[model samples]
Target: MLKPQMSPTRELISLDGLWAFDIERDSRPQAWTGTLDSGLEAAVPASYNDLFVDSAIRDHVGWAWYQRKVCVPRRWTSDRIFLRVDAATHEGRVYVNDSFVGQHIGGYTPFEMDITDLVAPGEEFRLTIGVNNELTNITIPPGSITVAQDGRRQQKYLHDFYNYAGLSRSVWLYSAPQQRVEDITVVTDIEGTTGVVTYDVQASAPSTVRVRALDASGTQVAEAEGAAGTLRIEAANLWKPGAAYLYNLVAEIVDNGEVIDSYTQTFGVRTVEVRGAEFLINGEPFYFTGFGKHEDSPVRGKGHDDAYLVHDFQLLEWVGANSFRTSHYPYAEEVMDFADRHGIVVIDETAAVGLNLAVQGGLAGGATTPTFSPETFNDDTQAAHAQAIRELIARDKNHPSVVMWCIANEPSSNEEGAREYFAPLVELTRTLDPTRPVTYAVVMFATFKNDRIADLFDVMCLNRYYGWYVATGDLATAETYLKGELQGWVDKFGKPIMMAEYGADTLPGLHSVWDMPWTEEYQADYLDMNHRVFDSIPSFVGEQVWNFADFQTSNGIHRVDGNRKGVFTRDRKPKSAAHALRTRWRGLENQKPGTSN
Candidate 1:
């Protein structure tokens, strides 16, 4: 008999109406002061490709402007108003009433600006956002590049996915009272069988805060009291995977005799660590049987609704997947929260993908042009990475499901002068949260030296597509070659190994072993051989397929859309390989120790 979880009282203000857009040419400063007359129309949460019928406007890159008017209610004046953007690509400058408010550089993380001081109650205010995605002369990762098409080098970006740039996620206006909860961090020490909850509380005025922890049966287990700063709760009912005993935290901010602000969060107590290559959760060895998922759907690139999120998790659960990786980028916070409630382990990743190919030039065809050149790793890139990392961690740190902090995905270890760049970034992750292990997925290059950065990580993961990408037609030979590589790493580093990524691209409509690269049967066979290889390696800790769904990729070769490496179609239809992998994972989980199935 568990008490029902309290829903967060947050309102989403839809910013999906008509917006005016135009391209900017010169680098010189220009004011958006004149009467709004661009006339170009676009909708929110819709990409530029969705707006224009012309291929030029749909594909061309430059500066664009989005303008709209928003009104605030008179009664909402007593609370703090925040203008939040789910995501904006490249760089953007936000303005209110033609006055510059703030600027953000990242393309994937959420950012907010306090507009309480600038907004007037019950009045329509003009909000203008200037977005610039021009090809920079800098050498940082993810810049436009010229590639050889039909033996002629043509200009293209050195990224792995389609650049469907815009205000991609969501935009909203919300009001919170002046005195409220700023941040909350929950840490579990399951080895010691104890729980520590820390709340970084902020308030506009002085107030006393009382915190209480209640078990699933509504029994008060632990309590604490503090002023307007960090509050900690100790020795509480801990949370585990199968025995997921969660607790509810209720915070009461009282000034006089009245409750000023109240905040409640459901949290679980658990500890996750990497022992060599094996991951231990709550002092018991656990294997990650999971899939790599992108935040995209067939009809909507990233426009998935709440029901879709829940549906995706249900599918994973059905397949006996105990873990998930938010491939290449940070997912919506709600998704992580749901993972916590459902007892699934999560690898919370940053939006720092595609930076690898841009920074290192040799892997994708020995091209010398670097996207994120080491020369241009300046304050702007650093600031953007820092902000993205901070927001991602701060938003999802409290969830018990998140076990590892992935700094970047598939970055090159053979970069020119930045061979040790990943090491420092791994250190940065530890600085932020020393409790969880830090790791990154690296491409399986024979000459690639991971020792430079491998020591910084608690687990070593390899994104190998040996049979599919390297061997192509001979999966049996590819299996042998991949096993050699895995054994070599295990003997050398003695760390736990995870097949971070492995899958074959296949077309949804086709199914045959003869379909070299685009057949569902071929995909299923590739996974079968790889899983068999994994069975022989006892040091191998886990396996997550290359992807969970087919997604948009501007860099694909066979398909103009993207790679079809998913176990499911973009529309969430199950593939034959998905069912096979499900059976394999279930068998492994049910197998007895010391007996090979």
Candidate 2:
């Protein structure tokens, strides 16, 4: 039996109480400074739509103010107090005790502000946060239309998910010692049959670095030394997925022979690369058989506990999946850590969604027409996009399970100057970390046309929703159409391709062909068709279904409750299609070349 995984330490500060809120109209700088009595109770981290049923939080475009009071602990004062916001929609300005702290301009990336200077030990301080998501603001992306305050028209992107805007992830206050480990990077290099592991360490201060490699028995197999930088160790004990061999890397930041901070990261020494459309891991050909996953749970939204994440991982492992894609956005850091321990390959993505296609019009006096044309290509918009990418990479670059850095997921193919927008971002990722591959999910024909930036990526991924999105008649017809679309890119780009996302949405627990395409039966049949296509196509690398679990969607169209394309329900119950995929991927593990299991 495998040892139970240890959970990371966490403390959540409740923001779900009474808060003073005020909506601002058209202001030059969009500032909120006045203090007001708390009138209504709004849950922290919950969307404004969930609390105020009548408030036009979703379609309305302007500034919203949220104010609350928080008490700091006396012990926490000795260490540095950091206020972390996991996610805030659009743009935000944070203030502690009327003192400006910092500002962040992205909806999906995490940001932190040092509030130690602004707070008094064991004293209560008023916290104020102002958010502006106005559509007409040239700094922010424009919607399909611009509506008036009384609800007219505005510009917005046209999309298929709901826009539940607020602090969607979490807010927390944590204390770290002055000289703590800031970040870590683990890299595995394999030459012939020998494996070499190197660790790039970062610290808050100058400290001695002690590195140790341990085996399953807790015996030290290798040891090396360096100070506050890169440390290397060579060993023959490499790890493979099924073989389950793993090594523990312990790094100690020492100050005058006293340990100031220490961090232990578990990593397996293995190398992975794509060769002629086949993924070779540890010098052996491997295929990525998995699903795309969202962080949201049914009633919990994005507030699900660690048990939920672990339960989903257990289900994925049970179904014989070896890979997963963080569809649309980046997942929490702990989720990637779990993947590393379980030996699952992860494609870490930045938090960029349907910005190019969200409805442009507002509810009041904004524009009327929905614009699918890209508006995320502007200089300011591009800077905001790049910031999100950089934050994601900074937070997750250390995880060993992550094999690919995904820039975007199915951005608008018809957007103006898309190549100009994405080419530089791809280059930026390569500059940051050249060890891992960079990829973006593309639509069939629309994205492949631009070969100028196509050569920038190591692997090309296509988000093909053929049997579901288009009326391809049947699975065979869908397969034929998809192959024809991908063939051009494979020939022209000379890179391995992955069917990044492909799945059909269906109502859970509902069965029958009468419900045809929208029923569970249809979903299973769709997976069967996808498996056949993946198994037969030699030019394609592998496939990841549209989702691993049902998640919240804000699009006014298609996904009302959530995107119902998951192979598992939001609560982590398996759907029929999940088992069908297991049969195919597991069977592949036993089959030899030219032989079917």
Candidate 3:
């Protein structure tokens, strides 16, 4: 799952631009026919939903085709070419010049096809990619589709976010040598003044491996000669919050002292752990101050935009924040890379949202059903969930910014069969990567008293809306209830607690003198109340607000345009709550553990 990069022994090309787009209305199987017949064109590397004015296009449920004719470089004749799709929403199928090459399930993670035998260099071929936006009971983020009398398939799910689907990430055409480095796994550690990097390289053939660690200035600090060995640096510069320092690890496969393959991996030397009532980074307690963010913006929907990404990180830094959670799904790799370079801590999560049937029923006033019933999220769902965990760990295991792995968000931890469902997943995460802690965000219904899976996690990540959802604008009672609930958590389990989500939906410029929900003043006041309770609890280690910005959601009466819980608007304009957070977080920017600003 190594990201495609340009190196001395590798060639890269971006297959990003306008592509022939058309909808597949019938459920019948369709094969690639070299070119799409439809006249509609859509941009690659973006969600096709918001780019069109047609509602049918925006709400497309089944398969869609994106075809682009590309030319392979003649110089890549001796190399094995690859077609790497950074991401395909839910499912994707690849075709080379008219024949199917490969397919992959799971939306957020990357998948590639080695198409060396399918196409020839110095020639043009029609590259077609079919993307499906369907989700069923067995999918990671489970959903259902029901056909109406008019034969229209409507999608229903437990999550509140919109199903903006397409190839929202980059597509790459890269070349690698026949005997190239296949994969590399790196684990970092710090010992007093020395930085330790232990690496394992997987190559295609038996070759001499040489590893070099270079500082930010491109000077070699350490070198080792092995496929698996450690590079120790004296007086190492540690990667800290707000002060990121990266050391590039260059791994090479040498044949008779001549390099045959080379790849560079940028990594930060850091360590994460959970000890009693504290979440420590680099052997020191680190407090988190940020928000639960989404890959959302105006027009782009869930598309990955470089401008939006840079601006969002700037805003996070401007607000004096150091961390954020990839709320419900794994975001684009570019987002993760930015976080790594900028020293932003991340709670990397899977798309295991909407697993709770009760939450969906509550949100829509529907009949509640057992979440883990035979007809619902059962064995097949568990298998899909397990696969999601495997892919997530394989993709993001080496990221220094990812301090924790959030397996699921807002699952029905209080329901029956909850323990059986998540217990093994938690154990699986630890078995895969024993470096960091594992957690799942707790819904408001899954309290400390009734939650069955909280004990399995290392940190208790609670997403509660005390004043908004429970007390309904009653700040005083909200504060009291919040404190009591948090105290119950501390008394029940002496683990460190983090407020993974807490916010009031506030419309921009909507001012009210009194404590009213949806008003700017109320959102600010609600956060203040929650902060007071967090400070009162000894186990509280972090506070990530519900959202970083307003985002699109499915059509519902509860949502106006979309979720307004963001401290900033969808266009990156700050709401009043943003200023309030800035003032508070600025003071707590350097606050030590167990101390108030």
Report every candidate's CA lDDT. 0.68, 0.67, 0.90
- Candidate with the larger TM-score of 1 and 3: 3
Report the Cα lDDT for residue 544, model 3: 95
What TM-score against the true fold does each predicted structure earn?
Answer: 0.86, 0.82, 0.98
lDDT for model 1, please.
Answer: 0.68
Q: For model 3, which pairs clash? A: none
Compared with the true structure, the alpha-carbon lDDT of candidate 2 equals 0.67
Winner by lDDT: 3
Better of 2 and 3 by lDDT: 3
Q: Against the true structure, whose TM-score is highest?
A: 3
Per-residue lDDT value at 430 in model 3: 95
Ranking by TM-score: 3, 1, 2
lDDT score for residue 29 of model 1: 70
Predicted structure 3, TM vs. truth = 0.98
Candidate 1 per-residue C-alpha lDDT over 1-597 given as tens digits, one digit per residue, 9 for 90 to 100: 011122243334667666877655444374454445767876676555545766655565655677888998776767677787766765677888878889776666667788988898788888887765543333223455453554422335545666666665667776766776555555556435456555445445666877777778887877777742332345555555534567877766777756666667678877787776577877667778888888776544554357788889888877778778888777766687678777878888886665545334443435365423545443455455666677677777778888888876765554553444555566677887888988888666522334346656788778888777688868878888888888877887778788889998877778664747667888888888888888788777788898888888765456646768888887788888889878887787765221111
Error of 3 at 87 (Å): 0.8
lDDT per residue as tens, model 3, 249-278: 999999988999999998889889899999
